[model samples]
Target chain A: MSSDHSHLPSETELRAKALESLLVEKGLVKPEALDAIIETYQDKVGPRNGAHLVALAWTDAEFRQRLLADASAAAAEMGYFGRQGEHLKAVENTPEIHNLVVCTLCSCYPWTVLGLPPVWYKSAPYRSRAVSEPRSVLAEFGAELPEEVRIRVWDSTSEMRYLVVPMRPAGTEDWSVEQLQRLVTRNAMIGVEQALAPERLAP
Target chain B: MRGGHDLGGRQGFGPVNPEPESEEPIFHDEWERRVFALTMATGMLGQWNIDQSRHARERQHPVAYLEQSYYENWLAGTEKLLIETGLISEGELRSGAATEKCGKELRIPDAEAARKILTSGGPAAREIENPPRFAAGNEVIVKRRHTLRHTRAPDYAQGCRGLVREHHGAHIFPDANCDGEPVAHHLYSVEFPSRELWGGGAEPFDVLIDLWEPYLTLVDGNGE
Candidate 1:
């Protein structure tokens, strides 16, 4: 993944480097702290954490009850509570009702579970269109729900972050939590798309 | 204020061209990561709350706000916060050096402490003895006033009537909290029908938004 751009850093890159050096020199921020925050989001916390919770909800009925009842507490039970997810509200997708989440004002995502939000989530197009034309937006993601099913869009205006527990696809009854987790994509958890079907997972 | 950041329900923006989830990278480049980290680290300084940081970003001109990328907006917001809080002067920032040290004693968290603090997040919910003005099943209208500062009420819901779906207990009101006047208010999940917001062409659906008490007013009778 290395490129021959060692001598040609972008202007933003230069400014960031300059800011980091200044902050460090001023003792306002530590270099190690910066790396830790990046690493925490990059490696430790991610969609895999959310996938674990979704898989558990699919397999364990009692856990699903707790997750739906109070998402933050249930997330803490699984050791997945933190910044950007202080007040998580899990909205499950059912056959009759579809749930979609978007931060109209800003990208208020569940970073503790979903890690840093995708570029599109913060983009102008997604922010404006998600609330106005959710169905069309989901269609762009190739998520086409039935016409009869009611769509409920959750606009995250406050500190409350939303997590969409996608419905379990057909033909995955006997699958283990690990196997089911492989089917849960970050987009599905964000309610842009549905969880992968069993056939799609096959090579 | 009707800032560029609040872009819900308004039109003229084009289609949402989303990248395939399987292929999208977390950070498009190294600088994006750096900007993100810097924002979070400086935010930990406790000089400004999240709402204030958001207001800083929204304070930019509409054209600039729309043109700037996500991390670019974040970097801009960080610069505003630093200057506003007296942590660094514009001259110092321009020089890329510390001209004068901040007089106030600021507690800067180290990497380990930041990790711990991030893991155990700070919740905005507060324990207030005041009762909620609206309850579930009650019809309420979103106040139509616009303020030129930090506000949690989105423009799309302004003047729209919705049903109170749930009472979310007391939480720090962003409008007051951002102004350095911290006050607790009951937040509720208001459910507005799509037709109510978008008119006849809208699909049969409901949009739920969490609104603080001050942003709402109860309907007199007949559910409006």
Candidate 2:
């Protein structure tokens, strides 16, 4: 079935503005609501939430078990439940095995936890190749796992979103949750990079 | 439908040169934010389900589907759904005019509900009368052929043999969700060997997909 509105593809920004103005004029979508939604994701929700969960898992073992068992509920306990995160699954990276997340069909991410996905995560190259050649992808992201280590690529095909809990750095065993939170970066939780070691912290 | 949106195991895309996370902005420009907000807010109208909205995006011409940026597709899909659901029209879309107040009769969410809407996301899982057909540790084969309508079964895993790793109880069936009454089926996390999906030269690893019951069939004890 061909689209009659084929001409609408060009001038993306202009078209977006037209649509928004139409909706706002019709009293269907409030401009303030759009600003609120944008602000929520932009300021409040994002990688910091995932970092908090990772930091807690590192400092508290029982929370880690709960998180691994039922991520959605565990996340809700810390108030990290929302869109793209209803059925969240937390995957732990161990010395013997590594985990990476990708959505081949579309970008399905834990929006509430990790905020918006990075551009590469939604790009065609990463979507097409991540599942096929994860070692190369991981290497490009500066996460070079040993050849002996197994890789589990979780394709987010369904509603079940995944978050990789990167192995806690060795030297930070005694670090506080607040300090450990600083080491957990957004890319690390996506399995593209490992959590930063204590010495790597910024001066 | 081996829709063009299915990018798994496909080749020839260049390196994924990701921007350094320190500098990458969540929304590259203001329009992206508008598109996202508009899509999410429009989605709150309850005119269409998530599967339908996704189909709107995937059903576009392959060139449009692949060439457009992520948010561009979202805008395209939103426009398509808006027109298809009678919430808007091609004329209105073109003129940026609400002649009919097409959305006047609709139940639209306001600014106060943004937080509630994002946090209490639309959960797809449901309780159905039928019990799950497959269980953990069961060997299964993905059915090669199914309807051409919207489906979650990816092209790479079609007709391949795999093991049932886990069973997620009844959830909304995406394929059947294209039309008619809502239905739910058991969704299983099926694990296929990378070699099986790509080739023997593929990096040794496992690729797992969440497939509904209809997309799979049981394999014999002989591993046939």
Model 2 lDDT per residue over B42-63, tens place: 9888888888988899888877
Per-residue lDDT of B137-205 in model 1, one digit per residue for the tens? 999999898789788899998999999999988888989888877788999999999988989898688
What are the lDDT scores of the predictions, listed in order? Answer: 0.87, 0.86
The 10-residue segment with the lowest total lDDT in model 2 chain A: A1-10
Q: How many angstroms is residue A11 displaced in model 1 relative to the true structure, after the best TM-score fit?
A: 3.0
lDDT of 1: 0.87
Model 2 lDDT tens row, A22-77:
98887778888888888889999999899999999988999999999999999999
Residue-level lDDT tens digits of model 1 in A154-178: 9999888899999999999999999
After superposition, which runs of candidate 2 have C-alpha atoms over 4 Å from their true positions? A1-10, B221-224
- DockQ of the two-chain complex in candidate 1: 0.55
Interface RMSD per candidate: 3.9, 3.9
- Report RMSD (Å) for each prediction in the order shown: 3.2, 3.5
